[model samples]
Target: MKPGIRPAHRPVVFRDKAADLASPTRSTMTGDRTVTWEDGTTYPMADVEISSASHPFHTGTARVLDTVGRVERFERRYGRGEAR
Candidate 1:
């Protein structure tokens, strides 16, 4: 590795707004806020809009759209069964 050429990896706190979850991790991102972890160590806090804590996929709250109804509506409007 080149000397002093790579980006610095520092501990940062990633905060999920919706889920109110925060954790410390190594990242190159910078932030103004700071937070202390359970180990009594402080790091720059980065606010994030979404994360696994609040995400629909991880929380099992994902909404499934009904495509069958949409298909029927399209067929009725454009005629799918008849040959054009």
Candidate 2:
């Protein structure tokens, strides 16, 4: 362990535009913009494309892909000789 070898960790705000959410966290990342938190504290702003607030899984909006149909089509075309 050495002194002054670690990068500066500062307060940052990660904003999710789609969900209109902002979370304050400490990170070593830097940004050119700033944003105010709910507590009226200003911090470096980092725009994120997606977050738990807007993610399908987190929001329970995720849909199962149509894999069953694709599998049925493949089996019909290839013919499951051993199974049939």
Every candidate's lDDT: 0.92, 0.91
Candidate 2: which pairs clash? none
- Residue 70 in candidate 1, Cα distance off native in Å: 0.5
Report the lDDT tens digits of candidate 2 across residue range 11-56: 9988998999888889999999997777888899999999999999
Candidate 1, after superposition: displacement of residue 13 in Å?
Answer: 0.7
lDDT of 1 at 12: 94
Backbone clash total for model 2 is 0
Mark the regions of model 2 whose C-alpha exceeds 4 Å error after superposition: 79-84
